[model samples]
Target: MPSGGARASIDLSSATIAVTVHRQGATVPILIDGRIVMPTGVAIGPTGQLYVGLDHAAARALPADHRYVDNPTDLLGTPTHTHDAAPPDPVELLAAVLRQTTFYAAHQIGQPITELTLTIPPHWGPRRRGHLDDAAHRAGLPAPTLVTAPAALTAYATTLGLTVPPNSCVLVCQVDRHPATLTVLQLVGDHYRELATQQITTPHDLDHLIAHRVIDAATPDDDPLRTTINHPPDAPADDRHALLESVRAARHLLVEHDRAPVLLPAPRQPAVITRDDVTTATQPFLDTAAHTVKEVLDAADVDTAHLAGVIVRPAPGIPALTERLAHATGTTPGVVDHPHALADGALALTAAHQPGPRAAAARLPRVRLRITDLAGILALGACSLILLLQPVLTADITTVDSYVVGARTSVPQIGSSGAFAMLTALVIAHLAPTTWLAGTPTGSPAEPTTGSLIRRGYLAAAVSGLITATLYGLATGTALELDYRPYLTWTLGAALPLAACTALIAVTAPRIPADALPTWLALARPAIHYALLAAAGMFLMRAALSLTIPVDLTGMPGLVGSLGAALLGAATILTITDSRVLRALAVPGVAIAYALVFTYSTKSALIVAYLAALTWWAVRLTTKTLHLAFPNAGAALHRLVNRPHS
Candidate 1:
């Protein structure tokens, strides 16, 4: 490349947008004439006329009927008077600027503009890039290559021979007229990746800081200056615009010299703003910028000792900002030639990668997954574990708590809230078998027809049972004073009766076809298994608590022993039987005969009979839900058939 060879780049920022064309191989990167415009002020009227470079004041002053379309790419859903009266889009606005700049550069250099590159923020995702690409296409430019701001800055830095050592981390502090962004970039081998980034909103803060200082420097007689500086929202649009532009100019001038003269409305002397005044006014903003740099580094998990240096946009040369950045990052910051360093690096990137999907994807540093998902998963797991285990662990602890309940003595009657909750869970579990059966695959030879619903129901029931057990434990801890903590014996004792009843019913009960049931009941079969589990679990917990009518089993030990023995013998016979109706009647027959012959008291006999009847009824319902409706019922039946004498 020759010293005078053409190179062009565009920088689009929220506050300002500029196109710079410079020589490729020049020593200082000689800047030819360029076009600069306020991007925020770019608006299109209802008349389809293109308006560019209007200040914020003029934009807000459009007639009540007129709509302000600041960003062209966002006007997709905006309504127009008619198809013919459709307004210009963002692409047109962008194209017009590019066309104007290209024409200007071509006339000055006596050659047609060929290559153009664009520099954008690293955080701007795919959608924004697509918008820019469409705009460039409509602007009639060979899709200009796109580059990130940090990449462009690094490119310009390399050109200036201010490159950081390989593997070193650098923080880029981008403070423009819009919001400030602090990006941490690590140079790995020869490539750079963005480690972390943070955004800070300080646009108005800086402007207000400067404006306040300039106004304060005036004489006490300056009431007009005070009022203009205050800049009420209801003020004329043009006046507010002038005040904003005035403060901005003073800010820029303060960067170069000690003092800048600011001209305001009449009847007030021009305010002289010193660099010290600007520093004092903007101390908070500078503090925030410095803090943001440190935050970005912290977010990336990089130590300050590992930092290479902080790189800031060049023009606003404030030593206070440099000192604060050094203190925050433990490294003195370096400067680019100007904010245009972005355009320079963009030009470098354009030469390296051509415009295409592959090039664009490869050029972008791969984004890391968000940490929030992992945090959420951890929180959910912790809550579930606590819910499951809290009751079991705290059973003994409740004994101590019962003593501390301050003697609100009442009748020892059981409340129904825990029972009701368990019942609800039971109903839902009961419906699981039906749902699984309905959804089972029937047409395929590869599919097994009988066991799908049963397996699903069992699974659903087991889940619901565990859930109900957790709820029962929690509720019992709050409602009753019983400790079942050494839980293994109680668990086995509770399971024995349920198991025996299930075995007997499976051997004796008549098999019912799932489709023969009512439509509503059939649909609910899948959830019924879950309800059964919850009910069984709650019943077990009640048994473990020894909660019953205050009858003393110890007073009639002989009767209790006989009752227990009779139940065991009956369960064994029914479990081993071949006849279905006989198996079903066996337990009831044993209970009735035992109650008539062995009982000394009618209440004890009635209690025995009631327990037997309830168990048998539950067993019958469970077999229907499982054997007929459950997908895995055949396995249980097969196990029963193959069982030996034991």
Candidate 2:
């Protein structure tokens, strides 16, 4: 067995154990005092007798009805027992084995094993997984992290220093007492994706073949051994069971020795079985297994040249099977000889990788609220309140320019600002990060890619801007006391410019050059930072020009003429250079030209632009402050608010 120091120091109450349940038996491997130890899965007989490790000799002695062998193929099907009573539930039988194994491991470590990782067959679906989970719960074990056998084998290969590059394929073959299972898996980023799986069955059972050969060599054709073999049911149950057990023992012995002796029933001498005999028996199974590996590779469209490694499990080494696989794949296969290596691999993978994106989303709501989310809520709430109470809050300051003659403030009717506030709030609430966009936690199988995040950010900004313009148009039209037809025209006119600007920014932001940005702006993502900066500068300049420019020069006729010229100028400048610095520099000139051509009264345009800038600054500052004050809590809250409910 491979030896090494413990990978992690787990607490007694929260210790995790990894278990693999196969046709032969279940194995649970645990770390104790820096060494890995395996405890056998124990099953309870119907007669209340305890069978530990399902010893071949002891199992043979039990009545046929009471013999327990795990049948993973039919997890929900109960094995037949005596007709006197119903057999133990398949789930219950599995539970008994898991419970015994868990207690044994806990006893060795002097602590409770509160967590579990289980290796499951690749083809099993939700029903089978749920059944296994029910068994674990019945055994008083924690809900296990179920990993496919192929994934576990791939993980074990990595621990062995077998480097399979990303996007490459690895083949794993699991051979036990039953048919060998062949699986092809591809390494995608940090996780393994199963490509194909097949089960290879031999024409004859290896144990029966070995037994028949031994009997022929040791006894004459007319011997009682030949008669017993010819009709198993006619022989005494004890003799039949003894002969089978002896054959199994000899097969195991030959795995290490070139030759071994198999004891026959009474009045018969022990027969010597050579390694060649065992090989002849296993050769058919190995050939089938090798063919299945090639077929699985073809099915997965993976070439032998792209196959980075081949891994086989249940390691006391299957030399013939290994050789066949190596010859077929043109790559020497790595043998995991340690009996409990599958369980160990499961445990190691659980420790090394974080949950996937879906799992992280499910757990997001339970996460504690952070300071950043609280800040966002407060900032948004404060904006809504101010907008709703705008008429009352600014009732005293009715004049924007006291020095300029006839410059009276134009306050909207009571419900106009309130309606805009309600609509804006509704739009923003719905635009919060969706489930797919929220992504996984750090170090998870997959994280939100940079491109996806940028797209989401731009989408939010565009949607928000469009909605804000619509709300503004409705309120402004109501305050202006315009007729329905003119109001409709005015609303459309107001919305179109904002929409055009949003599209313009979206198109330009990505094309901006990195070196063209100032050193201060280099800290943030180029697209997001530039978009935000351009938006902020636009509003700030609009407010500055509205307050400073004389009203006559910004009359309706002059405004329309200059506004069209300014747009043409800005578009030309954007086409000429892809520098964000130049783009930002052009904003002030555009705003100045717009103010000269457009009649934006000091009381209306100035206040709206100033409020927009104030809200953006407040949100930005609050987010930064909260992140610095309570770093962890702020991050958690950000994820919660942004994470999609679905």
Candidate 3:
């Protein structure tokens, strides 16, 4: 993780991690072996995805506690991939960098990175910095930090004599698609100070038009949306050949259309655009950058009446972009330099301003952050915490039979993957412990009447019975006559099995101190809860989706059998090594149950098998739930269910 303590012996030559980069759109890795042999372009990883060469970094930066996030669930609660439409994630950059760890094996000869030098954009604020730090920590690249892109460039340049004439200014411009940054430095005797820097994203109707045109070229099967280069037409081209060629293309386009087309160079591409072409396709962007440079100089209130020459940089070789810059500044030298010039200037400034190696380090004071109310954020966090725990606390008994059916779906005929089965059971296990929490809420003091207790018991039983019956009737339809006796027999059969599980919860719950209930429930039960939540999620989702005439809750009977087998396997595994396997076993069983039922049964049979499975799962689910709830009687009842016949 990113270092947060005292300095350690860190060697730059050996303390390097391979970083893969997927910027703007290029998804690939560019390895940097601490020693800076690379000069063209350095790789920049997003946030913090880092790995040791050919090895996994031992992550040690997560907060003391962490909770499960509901993975992207399908419309019916089945977990789905978080790929498409995942918010514009910086994490991808981190991932790319971490992937580079593999290439290290191909060509190694080094020690693990102990210190990291991360490069982030200057525009990013403290919050962004904090998040980046966290990411770096997770990747095991934490230490004496380096947090600025320009700063890193300056450091590199300083090693190469990094000096310029006094009273001269070196302006740097990074011409890329989104925003173009323009920074100017003032050389005061021995140091180069940043006079002004501004980043501006072009805002013109031309890009919109071009964007529309680009999309129009795509087929219906394509991933239609695409982001073009961030700059307008005038950004300097890196090569004469590229610039001339693009100008030729633009000229050809000009001949074809009465209105000029917007010109933008793709990020990282070596294409060079001409000044006229840039002005035509993307004038506003260039104008903004140019205007900012002029304004910064104006703000300095410099005696421009007799200032030294201005060295304008249009991203190194892009003369088209720089030609205009020089023209605007009217500097005698008026030549474009490399983009790193500003960073080099900054390094010189820092070094000249503070001569010694440990200069100004102690002068910095402890800074406190000032903010407004945190109530909204705190409330949101609390609400999320509550909803996450809701399933464990309340035992509605509405679909306890379905829950058990989820258990029984483990039947082997369906060929459930062991992993899938455990997943389901774990899900249930999470909710089960919670179902029996709080000493089962004892009857009120004065109102403790046997009759009322009897009513409550009957009410629980009746509610469970009705929900099971109604769901069954709906799932099975009226045709297949269910021998109510056998149905009840199967449900009752679950009582013993469920009671056994409840017994364990009853035994464990009381042992945990009051404060630990939420802790255990939240932390230890993630796998268990998520799995069950996912399974129940699948069941309801499948059923809900089947809203029309005879919608299949799950596929077929064989699947129900498979689900039952999976559950059985999970029970065996858990018995041998009682891990969080409930949800693990059940979700797959439920999923497999649906698939099997779909494959084996006729449309009519699907309803019967699904409802039957639901009934079974519900019974087991509820019985176990209640067993965990009331310790004295619940525990006794649970033991009775699991115990051998007298």
**Mind giving the per-residue lDDT tens digits that candidate 3 earns over 1-646?**
1111111111111112223221111212333454322111112224323222221111122232321121100011123345644332343334234324323422342223333344444455565555545545554554324334433334334455444466755554445223556555565654445666676556643334233333333313242123222343443323222323343344345433533333333432232323344354445555676677677666655534434444432332233556566666665433323333333333333323332211101111112221211232233223222222222122122235443221112111111111222223333333432233234433335532222222233334334433433333232211122223433343333333333343344333333322223333343332232223323333332332232222244675344444533443333333222335765665455545544444323332433333234334434444443433332576567778999986
Worst-scoring 10-residue span by lDDT in model 1: 356-365
How many clashing pairs does model 2 include?
A: 7
Candidate 3 deviant stretches above 4 angstroms? 1-109, 150-169, 186-193, 204-276, 303-318, 332-646
What overall lDDT goes with each candidate model? Answer: 0.51, 0.52, 0.35
lDDT of 2 by residue, 1-646 (tens): 0011112111110012233321101233454323443223234566666554454455555675565543422445334455755554667656665665666566654445655666777777787778778888998877777778778777877888999998999998876544567889999966889999887777555565567777777788888777676677787756766786687777677678887788898776788878777667667777787788789999999899999999986422245778888999999988875645667666667654632121112111112345554454454444434433333222222333543122222232222233233323323322232223244446343644322333344455556645654555455445433323433343334333434433333333332221111211222211222222322333233323333332334455444434533443343344334568987897568556544644434324433343343334323433443332233576578879999987
- Is 2 or 3 the stronger prediction by TM-score? 2
In candidate 2, position 47 carries an lDDT of: 69
Who wins the TM-score comparison?
2
- A best-first ranking of the candidates according to their TM-score comes to 2, 1, 3
